[model samples]
Target: MGLVERTSSRCAGRAKAFKSPGAWHAAGFLAEADLSANAIERARRAAPAYIDLTSSNPTHQGLIFPVEMLRAAAEPYWFARRYEPDARGLLAAREAISRYYSGRTPALLVPPDQIVITASTSEAYGLLFTLLADPGDNFLAPNVAYPLFEHLAAAHHVTLRSYQLDESCGWQIDEATLLRAADARTRGVLIVSPHNPTGMIVQQPIAALERLGLPVICDEVFAEFTYRAPHTPPLAALHPALPVFTLNGISKMFALPDLKLGWIAMNVPAASAFGARLEILNDIYLGANSLTQAMLPALFEHGLAFTAAMRQRIRASLDAALAVLKGCPALQVRPPDGGYYLFPRVMCQDDEEALVLKLLERGVLVHPGFFYGCEDGTHIMISCLSAPEVLVRGLELIVETLTT
Candidate 1:
């Protein structure tokens, strides 16, 4: 008691000197952020009955699941309480993923040894960032794609250089723009097929990726949800000569976001070298859970019906929303090539942020263009994954708000 009291008494005098506690180097990114978007705040406080055009989650959009099949798949974890851990995930789960790819439209034959599992695609991105780049290195990413890569790069102390996806050319990658943006410090390239918000698949000739000789990370989470364009082959499968890491997950693939399972399929012949280092990194974190890994094989084998049903709903909602938006002359609706989003450009002088707030005030919510690095004029992104009736009502509200 005497010793503890003396230590507390000495430290209490110096406690007044503590002003800024967030001294961690990695957390500096959070401190520099400008999160003063009133649109987001208003949307958060909107009434519970407000129509959400921004609903990206499939589980809440009224889709049936094979409950018994999922329950049966998870039963093994209870009986076989084996706590065996592998950095690359369970052998059976890896084999199941390999088989799932090998049976793809054109067949992408991936070896189990070349696969690394993670809790989510977000974690998979962290692993790839660590594997490919040093702190000062940069990666080239599509300018009009999802804003997530920016945050991920910041967290790892890596820079993300913007390469334009020309909207005039159907969101195709402008190779000249990419070359201009990249420098010697560039370590890799990220290509998101069925790009978020833009909805353009990377269908352009990418021989330049092999020429640049940097590793390519492709995100094909929305590959199967294609509607306007034909399903492009997996980037890793198409460019086997290059070091390609393809990321996909149960979240979008099986509409099981709650179950948290994702994978990195490395397609380089020299993957063994990368695999060894990756195993050590994964072992340090060991983020993948055993129950989900145990259930993957069954999910892959029996979950296609659920996926098909979800895709059907997405198409139906998309078609209905597009039909309604077409009648609104104040907007230009470019039907998404794929994915469950409809990113229509709102033709008005109003700032996109103001428009979003106005929409929120009218009991509807949508994202502004600049939120995804789009510097162009007013564009609001709406998701087609919502229930059809809700999507139609949201589209009507948008039309009414903008036309007035």
Candidate 2:
């Protein structure tokens, strides 16, 4: 039978779980019971505009890139464009990624042949899921992570086992929990340095990861936004013996998400064993477009100053938000090491959904902590990736609402 026929046959018995005539793999995501999402929609439709404290998109947050610079970068590609396809993406783009990594603090020297390009980080996750796990096999991912993994795992027909990140210990990985989450079927471990929503960088998990003897998938999309640490080291640089797949992109690095380019930089051993297979998988789709690949070199060369300025703006916003939130007696917040989010514990008896809804009624919107797998307490996620004045005002409203 053909691939489609085989997939249809596999999903034949699972029709009841699906809302439509779609693959059984995506049945769980067909519908979801999210009270906070519903409340946000209703609140937006009502009177009195709301302040969005959970805004993270750089484009929407008033961080504009230089149009002339972007134009200049793409202008050359328009005139000199030729359709040359490589299974691993454009050679020049991969070389540019290698050069960018070489400029990091620890300076990881990645070879162009070891890198595989994808359209976006989301697509990179999908590709990695295919590369690492079979239908029934699983990968270990951190708890309190962005929800993207769950969706990606579902689409790929794999399971994601959760490992704990101890909030009391600055959200560091609990070594014991991590080991316990692994089993014979475990294919790899996913690590998000400078974690989303909480902003905790992976400081000391290399030794523990070595014990597991599994490949590491490090997501470093927010690597450049470090606030507390002197600099965030590439996990690949820290561990030479282990097979590390470092994922990053221009989306967060240069706020160019629309351009659609992300990549996986494989360590030496990983490339030696699995590079051929990954190249085959990437060749089937060749998902990344040619225009962005041509512009990547220029983006890295001219975009550093812009990214540095953007980081300073985010730091100022974070500082302002922390200062205002500190005055609230009913909330307890710890400063994050990196990234643009603040996860603060609500020192109240209100339920997570109720608290989010209450804040929404008061005209400010913040994500409930449960959205990011926070189960220990009632927490709310606040993004400082907004305009300085807007972030401060939104935080002030959160304080007033909780205190009253």
Candidate 3:
């Protein structure tokens, strides 16, 4: 069966268990076999070390932020420490985030009161899931998407309906498939602009989304890294009538994932109605640390230049990798509209698992498309976040193996 069918079957099974009082357990924690990871680990113990082309961690990719600047940003927090906490995060942090949104291309005015801070985007997802969905309610997500949504949904006892993203049409949302997937139980629609792995941005207007009348949860972590598109308009800015919750953080923006700070900016007057309940939920955990909240304003003040430099470096690496990969006749690659990942279709007849293993044997590691729910065709995901030389070398190895 396909990814959507499999997901539906699994969700149906999970929902049935929810009806029984004795069936309560950590079902989401169940692990499945990952053949590619096992093979890669085995390969690592042998002669040649594998060059990872799937590294997304900015710190590991030599994209470190200035330590002195970080220290200076947090210096004031050290001297004037207080334990006062607000459920919607610090006012200064929220105001800074408001300013950040207001300064975007088609500026969005997100009031500080409409923003709720979380420890990270993942945590924000968890909170939103709880806020929007009940035990058996569902949400719509793209078929070719990062697997985190599945896990988060499973954890909250919620189902995620799959919607197709047409690769032939530049990975745009298949509106028919999307509409068909939603039923009475679907509480929200999850949209990832500059989507992970595939890097397809939702540039067109979302008229189909308006018809559903459900809330929109947009992930914009890579909003600053658009390539073909001049800028990624915040989904909130595109449709003011639709209730949209925009999620972003400094992790991808400023290359500071370790700092662990993210937020949800609620748009539209209707979305703001949930702010009180959201505040109550946030107050329960108070997941965001006070120190990071204190440091946020300074980071925003001094980090724009750093983010611009990082975007340029990523663009250079992407261009170089694409130029080399396109030379290999066995691979059909397309330039992403944004972000630093290249999802190339493998024209070779080899099975996806076998192809990945073959690449690993030749000292390069990459992810198969199936890992990200791309079951329509055989594809591989490559990250261009590495240094230009390292990325080019890895791409050359992949090309050599596939062509041979």
Q: Per-residue lDDT tens digits of candidate 2, residues 1-404?
A: 11111221111121123356366553454242221324434555573778887766799988888899899889988788789989998999999999988999889989999999999888988888899888878899987877677667767877888889888888888889999999999999999998997888876536778998888999999999998877788998888788899999889989988889999999997898789999999999999999999888888899889999999999898889889999998888988899999998898645877887788888888877766767778888899998899888888899888888
Q: Quick one: best TM-score, which candidate?
A: 3
Model 2: residue 158 alpha-carbon error in angstroms: 0.5
Which 10-residue window of candidate 2 scores lowest in summed lDDT?
Answer: 2-11
RMSD of each: 8.7, 5.9, 3.9
Clashing pairs in 1: none
TM per prediction: 0.90, 0.91, 0.92
366: Cα error in model 3, Å: 0.3
The lDDT of each candidate is 0.79, 0.83, 0.84
**Model 2 superposed RMSD (Cα):** 5.9
Model 3 C-alpha lDDT versus the unseen true structure: 0.84
Residue-level error in angstroms, candidate 3, position 133? 0.7
Which regions of candidate 1 are displaced past 4 Å? 1-29, 35-37, 46-49, 270-273
Query: Which scores higher on lDDT, 1 or 3?
Result: 3
